[model samples]
Target chain A: MRPLIRMAWATSRRLLLLMSPLLAFYLALMVVHQVTKRGTDIPAIAFTCMFMLIIVSTFQGLTFDVEGFMASLPVTRAQLVRTKYLLSFLGLLAGLALTLAVAGLAHALAPGRAAAPTPEELRSAVALALVDAFGLFAFLPFVHAFEPSRGILAFSLAAILALAASLAGWGLDGAADLFRFFQRVLAQPAPALGLIGGLLAFGLLSLSLSTWAYARRSF
Target chain B: MANLLELRNLSKSHGAFNLRDVDLAVPAGTITGLIGANGAGKSTLLKLVLGLLPLDGGEIRLFGEDARLGGARLRQRIGFVQESPTLFPLLRVDELGEVVAPFYPRWDRATYRRICDAFELPRKTAFARLSQGSRMKAALALALSHEAELLLLDEPTSGLDPLMRRDLLDLLLEVIQDEGRAVLFSTHITSDLERVADHVAILKAGRLVLAGAKDDLLESWALVRGGEELLEGPLKDRCRGGERTELGLTLLCEGAGSLASLLPDGALQERPSLEDLVYFHDRGKESLCAR
Candidate 1:
């Protein structure tokens, strides 16, 4: 556990350093959007870019020779994978907090020009981020199991296929009814709690898969 | 003396290269030099013992426990230095030490500092900024500071200057003087092994061709030079690896005592060096079957 924490700290430090430029650019863009009254989804756009960058950087770091160095240590592969997952989760949490802070600052600077996110909008954004985080987190196991290029291709294919399935589902006769059901569920507190519970379970499932793949890996 | 490290029926295959049924043991208080040519599976074997590579078949026991089942706990008792130190490049030397020290239960900070001073390592320099030799020294410092009972090193001396190599060897010798510790290092440099290694294990084309006490192996094989007539006579079958020089036929033969009776009066016999053994074993096609 100590090794895991140490590794996570080191990984987070490197991630923060690597993303500093992008973070600055996003902040500048937020300020401009607020000043010009462009009415852009600044928080969402920033979140999306930051999320993608985090995923790419985390994958690159894991697949690089860093894995070799870590393997040589006294830590087991399961511990290493868990540390990576912890680091990625921390990165997402930090990115979300920074994005929200920037958005709040932008709102404060131009009170009448751009509106701040309402409570509902903030809740929805957090929920969506949680879902995206889990989806991205699940791909880490595949990345560890395959070569870099193949891993990227596999992740891309999985994303495309999922998108296609969602689109195809929307074309079905009962699709609108299912969408209305989800809307009602989100509107109610108890059902929303259930949704969050389900997402957490899914995330844990992904972590289990990653641990299995990593433990079986041969350096 | 108990064996600190043991391997039996160890086997792994990577395409054309195969480590077949390797059996070895390293007793405590001795340095075992694993000498082999390039691509001779030295690194592969080391990695397997470290659990970096999965074994196709075999058992690795370090300190009387099965290595695979021992997990990180057993690994704490061992230290390893790879051919290229795969340390994080962005971290400074001190930061790297801080990160790794917590993993080993017996980490000795005072010893680490002492080794750092002795090696003349720059603690504040980023790993990428250090010279190759310095980076290796940093790695060595970390490995030695752990109070490990067994050390596994792969090509640790390959890139250093002669003086640094001597210093590293002396350090290893000092480490093994405690008698409760052991070192297994792989290198193509036989002279280094000749200087410090109590036992020598020679690998050729992924198989351990010869392994035993260094002195005993040298005494067993004799380098003999005789006329061409000896090649066609009774000595032909006994010759391990031979070259037809302009002067005569030079060969390595196992039975030195019997060679005196079979060869002509002018035949010469000399002790074979580790290099001669590896050269003849790897390069001499007929020598492969002779072993």
Candidate 2:
């Protein structure tokens, strides 16, 4: 393995061990919620995992004061940013996998516990898993770019504002009608391309901001 | 010879205390001990050199290149051990190696192993659980293992036992003997500096009060004792404060050159030690009127 990759793996292993109990607890809670609520859709559990992944990555990723101590080394700022991004993405994947295994096992064992989920429901589950995973993966490094202490509050506010805007946009279709027209436009291929383009543009903007911040930050 | 490191009018302030116009340099392949009292800007100087704190004014150059604007390659040549740095408690001994090893291009695994063995550090033990002395040893092990050209050590020996302090100093001396490498070590232990320091710099209230080669500082001072005649006349200017006793007055004066002739008859003259010179310089500025 490459040295950067090896370092990421070594750092994650210990943290992952520390995280195992919390992962198990989160899984157990999701299983219980599914059993009692009589809802079999996996999308909800995956969505929750997205939030968990962000919180975990933000706290765990920079809990160490390694930056100040190790700043004298020959490593570049670009490499450090890349390593952190990779680690956050890996955490997202691991969180998703753990959720699926725990939830799937619970559902399998407790027969007749939930109404059979539809094919559409399963598809939505997979889609939500991918979307949330990638979305948070894209966003995690920006939060970390601010320094961990400030990053926690900054990312939380950003996430809250995004969630509020999304909720408001969802409500706009009935109340404003113009939002319904925009949603229809977004559904079409050409318009969807524009939407994806906007997301890509934002991702690049965040990347640029994070790179600048990391470069200027004293160790 | 040009300095391995130089600070030109560098200044930084934290709250009311200001480190002002602090210009200093360490010639290549020499040990320069930074002596100061509490809040005397010793740690601040080290932090500025490492770019850990933003400079309020002036410039710092490491090996003739601007350190503030330096790149990763420039950073590679320097090593630092902070007075009270925060270490990653989550990492075990070997785990720390994994984290730090990738940062250095020329990291030597054998050297690291040797240091770990020399310090008797358990590979499995977490860093936070180690004793204070052991933590210092471990930090030293890491700093020395990188083979850096300049070692910036901030109070590296302040908390160690006598044996550990001696060992660390000896290790540093051994490293210095190889030549081409240098050390900017800060400590309150004047005796330690006396033993191995090639040069000494004294900082007082965020200012560079005195700095020069150790021998020059020592050789330039004369300790004298005499009666009221020594205290009453022109000889008063030479007195670098000593306690007044009924028997006589003890004093430190600038070198034996022209100053010796003015001392009263029966006054003793002896060369001051590095510690004596630095102590009087740091604490007795009131007695030294600029000529």
Candidate 3:
């Protein structure tokens, strides 16, 4: 019932209404892919879905010009920004959890159709999710500052440049190799903590940039 | 009169336009009409007060507290209805209330419901689907339901029909019966202000040319009408602005009691309306320069 949480809940409900069909369609597809023992690796698909959901939800959450209405309320710009960040991260986490939970449930229900997902595959999926989330730092400010069309363009450009840079660090196999390289790095404790610390620091910077960009705007 | 809201040396710059050094006070138990042409910064001033737009420089004191930074605490005591009410477009009349209610600790849902009923607002209809009058009424009802001490309304009557405008003005008069509540209403429609305004501020190009009690201002100014020949010369010199209509000549000037002896037969003199004030002042700038 707190104002900030209420705003988060309100926004989440709206986004969920829009996201429901897209999410249901994807989850059904995931279930069928699992049962039919399909072509693509399950973890890769899950990572891709998480990235899409996080980015799409970010766009949906901010597309409305509700600043005038929201600012007029008893909430601060910082609180509004916090709601956005909270809703986005919560979307990412929920999608990942729901995919795993729903897939596990499907596999359990139809045991004859598909084998239980391996722990290694789940771990790799988790690593991929981490990388995708880390990539979000590149364009979180864009999401706050620009409209959807421009924001998505900036995000696409960032993704392309990131992939190009990653190819030099890993092999030419691109995303799969990038995933393998990060998986190896995450296995090492010191480097894993360092990556997380870097992500946290980057996240704080993104938050600051987002807040500054949002505050400058007049409704 | 104790001022409930005061804007001291307020200024804001938006690219090509700047509102500079405006000082106005709204006392309790009175309605202050802010009148201006389009793009004259009426909405901008209102937004700055409500904290929707940050002030580049100056101080806003509401209930005697520094509101220059505009926050929830300051906004809670003020109810604002923008020209068209920028609420969530998709939420129905009732649903939007639920979202807005939690923010206002003093929100009264029962009173909101009563006002909605009184306005005959259709709670089930999409807010966008409602007629302009109905939409404005819904917005006004919502603003009143919060029990805010001061209401800042920007152009609340610009688009309504004559009947609707009358009803809206009447409702506004009724709301201000509680002496703790005051209103700062902005509109270009001087007639609406004539019906309800106690104080009037006329803005021209982002600055207030005139601001004070309505009756006192009208009492001090005069409108003179006569043949074009008698009014054309040095009398035009004394008049702030003049126009030669089909009726011959009309002039707006101060101190008409002294000028009465100078006018020829068939000359007419009377008090100026709010419309006359704006029209003469606007034309005064151009006509005076041409002369």
Candidate 4:
């Protein structure tokens, strides 16, 4: 457990340092959104850019031949794979928490009476987070398994798919269908429970893929 | 003496390059120098032992146990120095140690500090900023600090100056003086091995061509210098490999002392060095089947 912590610190320290400025920028954008409420789209654009940066940067630790270095150590490849999934899961939760915080602050600072977050708003946040998480886990395994270029290529393909999704209106159509489906599911008492299960399932699947890749890889 | 590490029928395939079925052993209280050409799979063999590369066949036994590397046994028992040091570029030497130390249960802080001081390594310097030689020194120091039973070093002396190489070799001798510790040192500088290595293993194009005690190998392998006519003589049958020098033909023969009687007057028969073993292995197509 101590070795795990030390290895985690070694690999994630750079990502943590890099996240500080991104977090600040995110919080600052939230502040701007609450002040005007007029340029709501601005925050989404900023959020998308920051989230993509995070996706790309998630495996930046692997770029410096960390695989070879870590391979030399006593830590099992299984443990390394587990650590990656663990960090990514934590990052996903952190992203959702930040969204909730921003939402709460917006409600508190409103000119009108403070109210709990609407069901629609909650669903929107969940949808966005899932899509982002899906995009991340898709690339994380390949990046960790192979060379750094695999990460770049994976993300590049993602960007292209995202562009195509927007150009062809697949993103809008899918989101509208998703919103309707969630609107009904949100009426259920344990909607959050279901979402958590889905997230775990996805995380586990990603973990298995990466573990297999890392296990078979040669430094 | 007990073998600290053993590789039996170890093999790996990377496209056209394949590390064929090869066997070698490192006994405790000995330093076995691994010598080979660049593509001869010295680094590959080291990686296979560390489980950095997947083994295609056979088994690796560590400390008399059929072992899987990257496990608790490997973590506590082996220290590895890569051909190119892979210490984190952003971390200082001390910081890298701080991270690596916890992984090994028996890590001694005092030993680490002493080695750092002895190596004259800048504890504050980030690994990326260190010179190639300094980086190698830092890596070796870190490995030594752990006091692992088996040290797997790949090309550790490649970047050092002559004096530094001598110092590192001397340090290795000091370390091997300990009862149960051993090292598999891979280097192009066979002279360093000649100075310190008790045993030698030479690889050629991914095959273990020759491996045995240094003294015995030197005693049996002979370098013969004579006219081109020698290559046409019955002596040619004994030559493992031959190269043309400015003066005449030089043949590397396996039966060392026996060659002296066979060579004509004015022809020379001397014991072959480790360098000669590697050069002859590369220059000769046929493997030196004799150890």
Judging by TM-score against the true structure, name the best candidate: 1
Better of 2 and 4 by DockQ: 4
For candidate 1 chain A, which ten residues in a row score worst on lDDT? A172-181
The C-alpha stretches of model 3 lying farther than 4 A from their native spots are A38-41, A44-57, A146-181, B128-133, B227-238, B256-266, B288-291
lDDT tens digits by residue: candidate 3, A1-219: 266566546655665676779877877777777778732255756765686577555655456555576777767777777777766677678657865775676678688775666766676766776666666666777766665457778878877877787677653555676567677778778987887788789888988988887777676
Candidate 2 lDDT over A45-89, as tens digits, reads 766765566455534547776666644455666666666665555
- The predictions' CA RMSDs to the true structure, in order, are 3.5, 4.9, 3.2, 4.0
Interface RMSD of each: 1.8, 2.5, 2.0, 2.0
Task: Give the proportion of true interface contacts each model preserves, from 0 to 1.
Answer: 0.55, 0.60, 0.57, 0.65
Error of 3 at B77 (Å): 0.8
Q: Which pairs clash (backbone N, Cα, C closer than 3 Å) in model 4? A: none
Cα misplacement distance, residue B71 of candidate 1 (Å): 2.0
Query: What lDDT tens digits, residue by residue, belong to model 4 across residues B50-80?
Result: 8888889989999988767435566578888
lDDT of 2 by residue, B150-236 (tens): 899999997788887888888889888867889999999998998889999989899998888988878777777777567766777
lDDT of 4 by residue, A82-118 (tens): 7666666566666667666665665667635434456
Candidate 1's residue-wise lDDT over B26-137, tens digit each? 9999999998889988999998999988899989998988998996788889888888786877777888788889989899888888888887888888887989888888
Task: Point out the worst 10-residue segment of candidate 3 chain B by lDDT.
Answer: B282-291
* CAPRI rating of model 4: medium
Q: Ten-residue segment with the worst summed lDDT in candidate 3 chain A?
A: A38-47
Best-to-worst DockQ order: 4, 3, 1, 2
Tell me the TM-score of each prediction against the true structure: 0.90, 0.81, 0.89, 0.87
